[model samples]
Each structure stands twice: as structure tokens, then as C-alpha cells.
Target: MTERTAAALRVVNAPWLRPLIFLLLIVVMWDLTIRIFKIPPYQIPAPKDVVITLWQEGPMLLREAWPTTVATIWGFLLSAAFGIPIAMMIAGSRTIESYVYPLLVFSQSIPKIAIAPLFVVWFGFGMLPKVLSAFLLGFFPVVVSAVQGFKSVEPDMMDLARSMEANRWQIFRMVSLPHAMPSIFAGLKVSITLAVVGAVVGEFVGSNYGIGFVLQRSIGNFELPTMFAALVVLALIGVVLFWILDVIERLAIPWHASQRQDVFLAA
Candidate 1:
């Protein structure tokens, strides 16, 4: 291959490079849009201005980020911890599934954002409201995904385990749980991102600190660049959390078929 073609081939083979390039391209487009439209910085600051805002406000931003991060993590863990067990109860007993599953589905239909203000009113302006708001937002997906995962075990595999005289717990531990892991992690990745949003919603309703609170304060003072900077931090939080989960999923289930799909990318 020619030198240019060989270099292109190498970039294609490295998984992260393409996305990095795409991100740069979008930034360029964003800058151009502002310049072409003569958009005032007060309305939408340039990327460079945002970078400067981040640099100037970095420490304060980090300080505020901790509360939201804690809330998100706690809410996500709460959903996962409670969701898996509830899912087990649902999958293990058809009667309970019939009664409880509908209620779960109906609960998800309610607008979670509407409930944020109520949480604040009840819990005051503390972390509890934020964590509960996030839990309410993220709980459904975890339960649904966990239930699907638990029920997804093939009958034949279950039968083979039973035929081998494996006790119910043994069969579930060795076969069912492992089989459900990929799905459970899938749900977790989605739930964590949602939890971040939910936590921010709570902060928006009422909070003394957090990246979300920063956004609210910036808006009142008309510090658009600072507001944008806060948004960037929030985005980074979600991206970082998602990436961590992705790594965990790979480590936890390396043998999964989706994890083994590198051959297609390499090709």
C-alpha cells in the first residue's frame, strides 16, 4: 500500500482513533457555525472560550461535581442491588411476576421529572432527594433488564443442569447468572447515564451544590460560558461513567460473543 493508504488503514484498525477524529471534526464544525452566524459569546461561547472557562473554574467545578457523582453512583448501585433481587423474585415465581410486573411497568409510565420537586419538598435540599430522584429514574430499566436476563436462560441448558442433579441455587449460580451478566451490564450502562440526568434534575429543582446547581447559578447571573463549561463537565461525567462500565463489562464477560467481535473490526 502507498504511505497515505497505509496510514489510513492503521487509523481504521485502532478503535479509538476514528472516534477522536470525529470529535475533532465536530468541534471544527461547531466553531464554524458560531463564526458564520456571528453568534454572540454571551449566547453560545466558542469552544476556546469554553476551554478557558473550564481552566479558570476547574477546581470549583470539581468540587461541585463530587456531590452529583456521589448521588449518581449511589442511585445506580441502589437500583442494581434492589433490582436484581426483585427480578429474581419475579422470575422465580410466575404468580408474583404476574402481579408485580404490571405494577413495575405502570410505575415507569409516570413522569419521573414531575416527581423531582416532590422529592426535594420531602427530603429538603439535601443529597437524599437527589439520590432518590436518580433512583426513581433509573430503577425501572434495571428491573426490566434484570428480569429479562434472569429469564433468558435456555430451557435445555436449565434442564441439563437439573438432570445433572444440580440444586436450584447451583444451577442458577453457575448457568443463569453468567448468562444474564451481559444483559445486566447493558442495563447498567444505560441506567447510569440516566441516573446522572436524574441527579441533575433534582439539583435543578433545588440544591446548594453540584454541577447541576452550577448551571442554575450561572444562568441566574447570565454567565453563559460558565454554564456551558458546567455542561461539559456533566457530559464528561456521563462519558467517564459509561466508559468505566464498558471496561467492567469487558472484563466481566470477555467470553461473550459481542466482546469477541474484534475480528470484524480488524477485517
Candidate 2:
């Protein structure tokens, strides 16, 4: 390649630039496909139409989005609060692991969508149901990853801590917790995104608020542009929440090998 062309290719391939470039390419291809095939707007709105709808209805969308955002955050926080302790208990004892782990797995096997209506019925279409749904979806990942992290702690390190006269709490706080942070953060990141999905699922089942409701309404009315716009909002919510967890992970575990690799890439 020519020197200037090679420089442009390297810039586009950069870690930070790659996603935006890919998104732009997708949008371009979408617009081209629509034009070439003469697709009906009602069947599939053009990208520009979706963008226009998003801009025109931005305020209303944001207002509806607030409830979903709140539900997602609350649900994720609840998952982390309960999941970590449960994981620790399970990791600390074989009996607890044998009994609780199976139950946890069984709970996940039940489809969230199948039971979502029950939450609405029991909780009365309130934020509680949404929060509960999010909790249910986000909880398993945290517990599983945390259990793995805690169990992965080296026996040698524990022996060293005991040799130094460190108590259980001190050893856990200083050694186990630090070693498990990367895995915990990985689970948190997954949980946060799933929480967003759970929140939307809750809204889909029963709420009168949130982007989910907007999507349902747009679908019923066959407002394809509005439907696409709501979908875009949902995608943005998931992306932003995931990105926040990633930032927090990097900050919280700067010494982690993964984070060190990220630093190397950025440099």
C-alpha cells in the first residue's frame, strides 16, 4: 500500500477507532441495501429515518428511558450485594456448594420470560417486578464467577497467611479478594448488561413506562421508524452500561493482567 493509505488503515484499525468504523460501515451498507432493493419504509425504515425519528422524539424517549435505567441499576446492585456473599459461603464449604449450586443452576434453567408475567402479577406492574426480574437475570453470573475466583485462590498463599498468624478475615481481605477481583469484575460486567435485558423484559411484560413500552407501542402501530429508534435506544443503554463497568473494572483492578494488556494496547 502507499504510505498515506497504510497510515489511514492503521488509524482505522486502532482499538478505539475500530468499533465506530464498523458501525459506520454497517449503516452505509444498510442504507445501500434499502435503496437497491426499494424496501418499504413500513417494513424496514432507512437509517436516516430512524435517526430522524430519534432526534425528533429524543426528549420523550429519554423520559421513558429513565425508569428502565433506574430499574437496571437497582437490579444489578442487588445481584452484586447478594451474589458475592453467597459465592463466598459456597466457596468456603463443600456442603453449601453441593446444595446451593444445584438450586442456582435450576433457577437459571427456568426461562425468565416464562415467569416474568408472574412477577408483574405478584408485584402489580410496579418497579419492584422490574427490579426483581433484573436481579434474577443478573444474579447467577456474579455468583458463578465469584465462586470460581474464590476457589482459584492458591493454597500456598493461604498457608503463608496462616503462617504469618493472619486470621480468616485478614487473609480473605488481603489475598483472596485481590486475586479474585478480575473474575469478579468480569462477572459484574456481564451482570450489568444482562440486568439491562432483564429490565426491558420486565417492561415488555407489564409496565406502562420505559423504552420497552415505547417499542411495544411502536410495533402495534406499525411505526417502523419509531420502533427502530427505540431499538437504538436500547442498544445504547446496554452499550453505555457495559462501558461504565469496563471503566470501573480498569480503575479498580489496574494491576490485573487484562488491564495491563489494555494499557499496552492504548500506549
Please, what are the lDDT tens digits per residue for candidate 1 over residues 190-218? 89999999999989998989988999999
Candidate 1: lDDT over CA atoms?
0.90
The runs of at least 3 residues in candidate 2 whose Cα sits more than 4 Å from the true structure, single-residue gaps closed, are: 1-14, 261-263
Candidate 2 clashing pairs, residues 3+ apart or interchain: none
C-alpha TM-scores of all predictions = 0.92, 0.92
Assess candidate 1 and give its TM-score to the true structure.
Answer: 0.92
lDDT of 2 by residue, 89-199 (tens): 998899999999998898899999899999988989889999999999999999999999999988998999999999999988999888888888889989999999999
